[model samples]
Target: MASTTLRLPGLGWALLSLLLAALFSSCCLASASPVMNGPPTTWLSAPVPAEDTAQLRVFLPSPEARDQFLWRLAGAGVSADLTTLGFCSSRCVDLLVPEVDRQAVEAALPADAVLRTAERNLGGRLRAERDRLAGDAHRTDFSGVTRASDFFEDFRTYAQIEAFMDSLLAAYPEALSGFVSGRTFEGRPIRSMVLSVGGNSTVVDAGRRSIHLQAGQHAREWLSPPTLLYILSGFLEETSGSANLPLRDLLSQFDIYITPVVNVDGYLHTWKGDRLWRKNRRVNSGSNFLGVDLNRNWGPNSTWCTEGSSTFPGSDVYCGTEAFSEPETQAMSQLLDSLPNVALAIDYHTYGPMILYPLQHTYDPAEGDDAAHFDHLATVMADAIRAVHGQEYEPMPGSQLYPHSGGLIDYAYYTRRIPAFTVELRGDGFIVPPSNILESGEENYRGLIDILPLL
Candidate 1:
């Protein structure tokens, strides 16, 4: 038998090398555990009682302190629910620790730390609110409404949202357009809608100015998508009716693109399995960990594995293997890149009642008139939101909340040079009841209307 030898081209050898490197990297990442780098500190040695079940609010003086505490908690294998209100500020966090871990956590705190609230049944209160909302939803009557397009009484499922988008396109064939902007890791379509008064435009027209509104980047923020839908409905009504001349004029001048849900897989997961899932469902190659925080997966100024985000695969704010690693984020980046005339972009989040501007990775002001413009627009939007329900929303730099990296709004402003805002709607936390859905939509709609004039 002739000696069997395989001859390979230089490109083939290079490909083989890349494959080996990838395999090695994956193996290393799979076996590597996330380590806490800070100096070790003393912890409470007493065993926690089973009945000591209540959440506590521990306030740290600074972000550094808060981060240190988080690392400590992680190291101790203690679970914590970190709130965003005082994130990067001196009033640095509402840490919800399990009853068993409360003593240990409280003891681990620095002397200057303040206990804002004693252990309370916050979970029970939230559950009660949800139950009440569900009861109200059952009692709601849709007898007079003829079309599915008119349904907006409660929060909708992913299927319902998609169906609603379809109905909008069917109802307004001439003015509204829909497309699968991208797909999630689980192959779910990331749907988007465009509202151009007078005619339907499938492609982005460079000559026409536009504003992009996106929501539901995080799975648990169910209030966001409905708010976007409400805004879309308002635009549709304007296109059909003679009323709201100002809104009609605004619509005529600018095409509005709305992406109701960016993380479809995670959103569905919330409904089907876990209610608090916050990231996109992306399986890590080496580990069994699933999901990547899409907000922490953008580029240019992405401070990966730092401050607000984490290098650990299991973290809630995991930035992913690399910037724009998730297809959802990549699709969004592409969408923004394709639209040159996008003057304003808003990424809606929840529970903070905040209108945050760019530079989330740092406190440094943006170049030229960018900072001024962001501040003006943010203040205008916040004021408009406040006028609706007398609910005051803070309008400030995103860094004021936390030193976040790779956020969508930050990417839009810093890299794309488009003015952007991250609107955290409603103050009732992530689980806003169905009763507040309509009000949240209306309040956000009012704020959105104010945004157009500034744009």
Candidate 2:
């Protein structure tokens, strides 16, 4: 019999115990880290509601100050809930900044500053903002959709998106089948739908070519999801005797799946609190701030920060704590597992008009690899789409466009062996406006039509 003796001095045991405690605590921390240095700006003196410890309300002097301040805050780890912004020859913006940085933020501003953390009546200010928007100060309504767009179900909320989905399904019941993909960290329902002429009969019974298209992984990219929605609407429309006849014919050939919004909680936060909420709402401690970049949560290439992302959990480009840590991301991962035959997958994003293929998540070229076949297919699709719209969409590997890692499109192509691309929808490279919705939607519809025939 062999006997081994293990001994630990009192101090050694204490250190070991402490290390164990830390390991346990980190597990409880939210998955994902932000890139901000030090504590996030806090409003030390603002009177907050009992139920809301993290409420923020900024009242700036001139509308110009509001825009500048909001941009600065967003640039410096502070998120702004913008109420109004526009251009009347020039741009003006009205916003509310989080209370976390109230004192330091105020002290840095001009003494005659209009920016304020507290006013005589907080509730009344909210009421006035609500009423102003209710009257359509910025002309928020969409032409094709009749419903009034507002904060609760704002122009880009999950509810409005789902309503639009319902409309698409109604128009093509035989071709559409809806599924609850999963739920957000905040428990909002993440929904998805499939569009196909043969429907489940084709996809389930025999082998069928499939394409998965998803958009709005980043909440602030409002233009991303709309293009997908428009494309779905066009594909399923019964254009019995119109120019869309070819598009109608393509829908019959391939099964198309769509996810309008991946980060529902963050999108809702954008409508209710901040217009630039770009991550999923995952709570963390030691600080009242939290969220993760859903686009950076794919499992294949974890820890690929420092290229186009950050490790400090407070930064806008924060990659999650670990790959697939997000339920929404995991849901998409599962869907891919179930639909392994997907010939092509697209994760749409925005503010940059381009069609990019793998490897965004890695610098390794897809030039001579087996993925070369899919890469060639992507070139064909990109060229065909651009020809129809006359919109110059550069077709290149992600590394060529921008160096990034752990992105969905990269994972789909490199790991799952499926051809995938990430389409950065129209925004003229960031100057998005509500009026451009229909035009952008139509362009995306045309692009999708051109690609569908090739697929």
Candidate 3:
């Protein structure tokens, strides 16, 4: 462990630069020893344990080079998670690499790609963050506590996020209500929060259109779950004049359903096991991998594992053994099916800082009305996001980014005819700073609502 990370070869000078630039880094990283000790147990070498994997920032020259880079990693028996791989710039991405495989992984990079350490000690960082979990927001004997004192200032556990939702339901019974949509594989409830005029979303009103928004589909995306929670908070605050947004009119015409955490088991695992886990905790039939990427578990049946999804259980982009195979994905799919007139659906994810639309399962852009509608609305939404803090969010068809099939947006658009979207939130990685919670939520919330009235 480097006593101080101050620019030595492979010393994570790049990551250290970010730590120095961030405001909270001074306090949290006062001692600044983000490293762990490991001893070889094999004769030659062994794969780095997943928990100890290091994050690498790789810059590829073009999108084609990105696919080739993934293939190179796959050839070297390495798995890359496409779902949350941060696309920080036009050609830059962040990936997790095992310490033992660093040399081989570097050898596997595209000829023109540039690689640098993003986070050299992932396990140490997660441990340090967990120690700070005492985080002042506890709801005791429960009178009125919506979130932790620093809810917007820190990323929280799934339990705390659930408690926050339940507290809001009790606090504003007339406007907010919820139900357990389904239980996860581990028997944890996948709760859905509803915001409507009368707090009843089980049945859609005669003239109302429904909107579904969810985050935490990929467990490692800690920023997403809280972003949705903050958005929900903004809506609640509006009723009391504490925050002002044009929600009353939107509520009049739409029944909004928000699910903060869908991958309950995997999310809990991140807190106690691996912080970079990107799947639902599913025990595969004969494989060592114990999870399935829920985002890649959606279905059109025929196109389930066709393109960007993987047939291999160990791959980060692995589409489940079968589409909608995981309990969490099934629960969400059914929830969307139940919405009588679902007008739009947004599956929130992280690190691209972009907005994406349908035609994801193939290499073709949406053809007609869907194309125009998606393009226009996505551009408008991206502009709305930039207005908040000048963070640019590119809007494009999902296939352009990557041909990910069985994605939630595709399921909603192709099968249900609902205008679906995916908002890849601000930041370069899953371990986004806690201070980003409020702004990420605010920009995305504003971008979303700004387009609602237009629809």
Q: Candidate 3, residues 1-455: lDDT per residue as tens digits?
A: 21110112343322332234222332113212232011000010111225557888888887767655644453453332211244564456666565666776688787788888878876566666666765543533333443333556777767677777777787777667788889898889999978775345445575788889999888888899888887777767664442444576565577888899999897887776456667787888876656777877899897776665545454466677788888998899999998868889999988788888898777676766878898899999999999999989988888777666778998998778767888888876776667788889889878987888767
Against the true structure, whose lDDT is highest? Answer: 3
Tell me the whole-model lDDT of each prediction, alpha carbons only. Answer: 0.66, 0.55, 0.69
> Any runs in candidate 2 off by more than 4 Å, and if so which?
1-156, 200-203, 238-245, 285-287, 301-307, 367-389, 429-431
Clashes of 2: 18
Q: For residues 185-233, what per-residue lDDT tens digits would candidate 1 score against the true structure?
A: 9998898888887545676566678788899999878888888887787
Tens-place lDDT per residue, model 2, 1-455, is: 11011222222222232233224434212111243221112111111111212223344455445434533443343222211121111112222333443443455354444442333333344344345445443443344432222311333446657766776565556667888989999988888898766445224533567778898888767777776776666555544335456555666567777898888887776556344456788774443447777876786744344344544454445566677878889988788767746777888887546677777755677646645765666666566656655665556676554355667887786566766788766543222445456556666666666665555
Candidate 2: lDDT over CA atoms? 0.55
CA shift of 167, model 1, Å: 2.3
Pitting candidate 2 against candidate 3, the one with the higher TM-score is: 3
Q: Give the Å shift of residue 296 in candidate 3.
A: 1.3
Q: Model 2 — which ten-residue stretch has the worst lDDT?
A: 38-47
- Which runs of model 1 end up more than 4 angstroms from their true locations? 1-55, 60-90, 110-119, 122-151, 301-307
